[model samples]
Target: MWFHGPDKMINVHKMDRTCMALSFLSFDRKQDRRKQSAGAAGRKRFSVDFPFEAFTRDIWIICVSNVVGAFGEGLYFWVFPLYVMSLQADYIQLAIVTSALMGFAALVPIPGGLLADRLDRKKIIILSWTPWIFAPLIYSFAQDWTQLIPGTVCWGVSMLGLPAITAYVISSVGDEKKVTSVLSFVWASYSFSYIFAPAVGTYLATIIGMRSVLQISA
Candidate 1:
């Protein structure tokens, strides 16, 4: 986390050491930690397997949270560029707007990682939800393309909590073998929501048009 910013750090040599250090600093469950040491200490699994205890309460919390977040993003993630195009933003303006949103996002991960280490990961995630609350509203009410700058800003700024979300799930359990398994679960959980959410968003778009869909995303 210190070195990787918001990027996954499971590959870093210090990741194990970091995990060990985090385990000591975090909650205790000797029963869980004992299970972690028996298998491969550091290997990433791309697929989810039943042998891994991947459906625990904490994991579900992350899954559910990811679903809700993904669902919200899904409503607009695909339609956003189209919506901006509807605003008639020229290529140059669109490029600038996209850059503004993405540029801020890149800066957030560094602070996000630092905050993940210093603060409660759950709380950080909870706080991160605040931007989504208003971001859609900003999009819904914006009368002109320029007004969307703030809306895009909120979406981009939300990247600040990404590291905390990733770190929270990996560090939730002390086992290294389980880390990759949990990572797979987390990826699946967040991704699975997209399968349904986009369809739902499309349905709603037919009923209310794109701008109102942004409001519902809130």
Candidate 2:
């Protein structure tokens, strides 16, 4: 092999270094593009995959309130007939009481829908929840089956808030496309409270008594 001139060797070395630098620069550019793409994908995933970002503050408040209300309701709803019977309600009386509850619950929602359309939904929700608190207290202090009527009526009236709550949830969603997801999420949160509260309520009733459990539920 012929030896290279020093100048030629130096030039060759410079060319090699330049090629290496160009290759490294190309690699860096590709890496930067990949990072940018990944970042954009991450941002898209955050916006699309996370549903809670669709809810407003009022939606969160409503969700929490519904959870607590559902929990309290679960504490008594399963054992309501037994409690009524304990107050000396006969079979016919029980039927009447349950029928009355159903009647009021079914009928009131008509006006409730009207009120929800006309009134402040938040105030309607608060008013409706107010009666539920008193209903449990009334049950705790009932002297007879007849005395339970007023409390059942109060409980029935609490349904007045349902439409308002539904409307509020729809309004609270920033994206209309997310309304179903938000409502389902909020409703599921409420129902989740029911899974354990009924069992706990029954245990508490056995330990302390049904009336005491009703008071605790209040």
Candidate 3:
């Protein structure tokens, strides 16, 4: 529902272009490897000439991507539970539904970490959105509590990218002193994305109904 603002839409487009540019601009870790070894024959394979250099271009790209996504999510998340209640779901059903999304917090980080180690961290962040693409679609079509499970599960799977995302951000900062503040700033972008989203969502939900908003989010 909140996605309609022309200003916000423009911001999303600009951010996307920025991410593309940043991706091309980022230094290759492999190239760094060659430079390190060429500079010092006896130096360790992973030694750094400049520790702050560990912070990579991908982190900037990620922060931009986060802003775009968090904007849409800020529109949908709180509205969803109220939508379920609108469906006349009972307390137990509500608990189960909420749990369906939360449950993945325990299970996904292992695979997320492995993926972080094995693949391009930027790509991991991008790929994480795939599961979320299905969530709004499922929510659009769901008529009952059981049908909501799939969307929530997809939402959970999207969260699997957190470990990879965190690692990238932390590595990019390359400063222990600044890590916590960096993380807080990154996460707080979600709050910043939608100052008016919940109010807009409530207004839209009242008029067009909740399912329509979910579809818009999708």
Evaluated with lDDT, which candidate comes out highest?
Answer: 2
The candidate 2 region of ten consecutive residues with least summed lDDT is: 44-53
Tens digits of per-residue lDDT for model 3, 1-218: 45778999999899889998877667576678788888776454334332334445666566676777666666678877777776779888888898877887678778989989999987888888888778878987888878888888888889879888888887778667667666766666667768877677677778987778777766
Candidate 1, residues 1-218, lDDT tens digits: the string is 26665455556757789899889766566756766864444333323354255556877877787889888888887777777777878888888778888898889779989999999998888788788678888988877779889988888778888899888877776767677777777878778878888788878888999888988888
Which model is ahead, 1 or 3, in terms of TM-score?
1
What lDDT does the true structure give each of the candidates?
A: 0.78, 0.89, 0.76
TM-score per prediction, in order, is 0.72, 0.77, 0.67
Residue-level lDDT tens digits of model 2 in 35-132: 99999999987766558889888888888987898888889888899999998999999998889888989988889989999999999998999998
- What value does the lDDT take at residue 10 in candidate 2? 90
lDDT of 1 at 107: 90
lDDT of 3: 0.76
Q: Considering summed lDDT, which 10 consecutive residues are worst modelled in model 3?
A: 44-53
Clashing pairs in model 3, backbone N/Cα/C closer than 3 A: 55-172
Question: In order, what is each prediction's RMSD in angstroms?
Answer: 21.4, 5.3, 24.3
Error of 1 at 157 (Å): 2.0
